[model samples]
Target: MNPEKALVWFRRDLRDHDHAALSAALSNAGQVYCAFVFDTDILDALPSRQDRRVHFIRESLAELDTALRARGGGLIVRLGRAGEVIPGLARELGVASVYANRDYEPAAKTRDIAVAESLRAQGIAFHTRKDQAIFDGDEVLTQAGKPFSVFTPYKNAWLKRLTATDTAEWQCQGAFAPGPAEGIPPLEQIGFMPTDLDTIGIQPGMSGARALWDAFRAGRLARYAALRDYPAIKGVSYLSVHLRFGTISIRELARAALADESHAWLNELIWRDFYFMILDHFPRVVGHAFKPEYDAIRWAERPDWLAAWQQGRTGYPLVDAAMRQLNYSGWMHNRLRMVVASFLTKDLGLDWRLGERYFADQLNDFDLSANNGGWQWASSSGCDAQPYFRIFNPITQSEKFDPDGKFIRRYVPELAAVPNKYIHAPWLMGRLEQEAIGVVIGRDYPGPIVDHTQAREETLARYAVVKKTG
Candidate 1:
């Protein structure tokens, strides 16, 4: 006899603990089949064959399969378009229904719709749950029953309505009893080559996420507010990578933050939801601006500047260091992400979309909504975005954030010999002083790409077309 089958289709949310679809599948059917599809719709557009994210995803899935197999279950991995494959797999397994967590991207939403329709045509029910974010579509709203264009009001309402009921942990493996089996495709079989991070031991699974979460709760949660700006302090929760893969549950993290006294950490989580909510309401922001009038402003394509930015040769210590980190590691510190994004748009006078695409390409934690929202915010084109005139001063930013020049020194080793006073702006130091440090601007270190003074003037003029100020 065929087991009373249900298939849980894993997308972003990868963990067995606090997984809604996995739990629902366990309860609704006698036996559950778990699967993940490396959707080609997303993968085909990626320029990098050596994508660290693809490797990260495969590693996470490998761990997921092991955990599932330990509990009389297994994860079946497939590489194809999910819309084409999920329904086919469902029919093959003879499942009554398919369950999955909701994804908010416009393309993803369209793909899921197609998948759902395909399953429905075959008499297989497709069920989806809001797993990645705290507030799903229409869950948090104003008194006016309109989607929020601003964040603070939305965040307040989101907090006001919150209870233990709002952030409940999902319990997997309640009562399902099925035969344990090893599952999932081999790493190379999935067409993703291994990443350097795999060897560096960045910790890529459920256990790693739990370890980070536990450590964050015990030691770093209190200092998060003060030290998150300083990348050298190790104050920020390294959970962005985990959160990107859904190796950890958003509800569990939210619950922990909510229970804790610090509102700072909760604010970061709120930013995640805020971006997710923005994406759901305004999918137009993905390729364009949330505020459309900014579209009128002509942005320079400036591929040369873009190439320099990507290569970390921007000739600004802070900006160059941040880019080097991103180029080398698939991660960029959140604070530096904001700083570099602002520099690209408001300093170099380059298009925000270029920087957005760069972040999308390089960031391991790159979620479309968050990355888009961030770039647009820096460019003053997002909903409730910053004003155009408020450009980041890279030198001041470096001096303030990396006060002792620790972050810059780590990535810009050429500037290692420079005195503390001149580290942030080596070009400002005298040639004799530079010689003493065995450093020469335009030789050992490149000169500033665009003088901040000239760049600031150019940025202001460029944004004059889109300025909203009265």
Candidate 2:
């Protein structure tokens, strides 16, 4: 092979196995170097000190380091803006090219472009491969070369476009595994403090991801579609964070789902591609809706209500339990997501943006497109959205999803003593019964923050502004 080396810039795709860019870099070059940059631009904007993402990433990176070291290569860890750090490393290492997976986020794209430009100045070629999403922006566009806004058509088009070629795994054995080039920086020098992520009990690395996937395949895959709604049930794959960062390959997961009898679990993964394709075609949907006119809808901003919702004092048993779970665990079941989002925008009459921001802050698996799609879907402002006329009745949603109150009891303990029949709306119970339950409405727990019936009417009136533009 040639004597030149290639530097693999590892971003969200943090794994060694089936890593396209890493495998590519190692195969074509005489020597290979792997690196990761903790972008200060992003970290500076984050508000929390004990962010689960930061901690999760730390553990994942450590695992990646161990795996790479076993192959006679190690990770070059750095703390700074990626645009500055990546190219600097490329030049310092005298690498012929820098390879990485593409990030669809606008900020990340801009950062990568700048890094590519900087590397080009020194005659270094920067190559970005698609690793995060199975189908990227333009790859699945319409026949006329137009992007899709509606999901059903988009999904149909996506399924039609997918080939066996698209799902094939890139083997990372042989020449790629020969060994990594020497000279990686120490982790401690990067200004990021060592985090005790193991204590949080979150499984880390590709091995952890496979272990979880194996268990899900054995037990959870069959009932995923039905049980995924209930928060108390371990219905989800819990692989969002892994998928978010490229700790595991999307192709690997998708291939297994496609082969398995469980179409339900696979459909969930398809929904992810659906949202990513949504983001790719319409980048404007990042801050605004797929339909801009929906922004014209007047919101009934009630700060007190927003605070109550955030604090999980909504008084609607289902919505409160969902919100409380998000605050505590940084994860929420898909059913609760729709219910609480509808409660916030439709019942609380607040802007969906506020709820989106909260989820962005709290959710470990928070993907921009999915989060935006979900919020807009609940608010009836995006493609394939719920009609503005329809609003989720919180109590009914609870009774339906958690009919026996299994989920409700886990998160809302104040309602533990309430009968299953009245668990959805405990405030409706008589004072004597409330006293007997030992949890007072508006005292032991919060009373309903806003009357669902009244608020639904208010939301209808509030969204009337959209009609003029439409």
Candidate 3:
């Protein structure tokens, strides 16, 4: 007997091409339908209405609907809880099964389970495919049959295990006529406001990801190794937001990396997979430290310090500039993310969770695993984290990566008049020099909020609780 119909539920994977569940549904079922849930269970929890991520997702969904229409199918969009919505949609469409790409985040996984159980009760088979990561949690285990804590070994094993078949793209083409043609809801209809995404020159959808990939391939791929660390340069691929939303396929990216010999960039992709594995194997890392002993170390109750960091008035040029960039564009350079995270946890003596939660709210491309892993890595509280003593000196980092202060000047324009020599540390400028520049250190731009030298010593003392474990 031939399969009657199937539903492809879009989650993080938003595009039409190279989709696992969509391809499977098309191959198995006589008719296939596509749908997306606004998922108020998640959306209502957002702290702001002007969220860039929400705007990006909405735009991408519109594009997806258009793309599907061209293929004789269209998206079915609903705004409700997925557990209730998916089953209802499946029943309405009379689908034999519901297929979807897997989402690995703790909350997403729980939701998927609930949806699966609901579909099972209705006698509708619910199937999930591996589309997000090249390797799943169990794909790259160690010699001792345990998940890896360190990245280097995991990456080595991942590379050794990789084959051409693993990187091959899943071709999802042809017309799927049975799909519904409902139009996407506007931002206002969904209770979200327009954000600065467009003003910041961010393009949404698959076309945007393709354009970015083409630009990166033509201009930056060759010199990515040399230029990626410098924030002032357009060195890194700007496809991060696209990757987060699955506007582009991970397999396509990995394939392009291999074809272009972009080893450094490929390593970064592997790092992403590593973090996913960590999140899957150690779920508690979401709220607590990976190394439990590190949790014993005390964090300061300094709301003023956190507020200064958040508002970009910490008085350190690099850290302040990074925060300002995040505040303005909803994105930050990776190198600067680490520097600013270090300043927050080590210099300001605040908990890493504070920085993590702040980033969760601010970043347009925020992935729970990557954001949490980055914060714990910066705070020296996660597996394979930098040593506690190896704190980042914000001033030196500024002078080195952004020696000409080009990045600093762009984000923290108050320091534009200061000479290159004093741009990284304007507080060092003599009163006459500050006056000559038509900017006063304390009046125009605030002085250093906390002395780095003093903070470094205090951070070391505070981390003494984990000294034996070190």
Backbone collision count in every prediction? 0, 2, 0
RMSD of each: 1.9, 2.3, 1.1
lDDT agreement with native, every candidate:
0.86, 0.82, 0.92
Q: Give the CA lDDT, 0 to 100, for residue 281 in model 2.
A: 64
Local accuracy of candidate 3 as per-residue lDDT tens digits, 34-83: 99999999899999987899999999999999999888899999988888
Which residue pairs come into collision in candidate 1?
A: none
When summed lDDT is taken over every stretch of 10 residues in candidate 3, the lowest stretch is 173-182
Error of 3 at 430 (Å): 0.6
Candidate 1 to truth, TM: 0.96
Output the worst ten-in-a-row residue range by lDDT, candidate 2: 174-183
Name the runs in model 2 displaced over 4 angstroms: 174-200
TM-scores for all predictions: 0.96, 0.95, 0.98
Candidate 1 residues lying further than 4 Å off, grouped into runs, are 1-3, 174-182, 468-470
* lDDT assessment of candidate 3: 0.92
Q: By lDDT, rank the candidates, best first.
A: 3, 1, 2
Write one digit per residue (lDDT tens) for candidate 2, span 272-321.
88787777667788778778888887787689999989988888888888
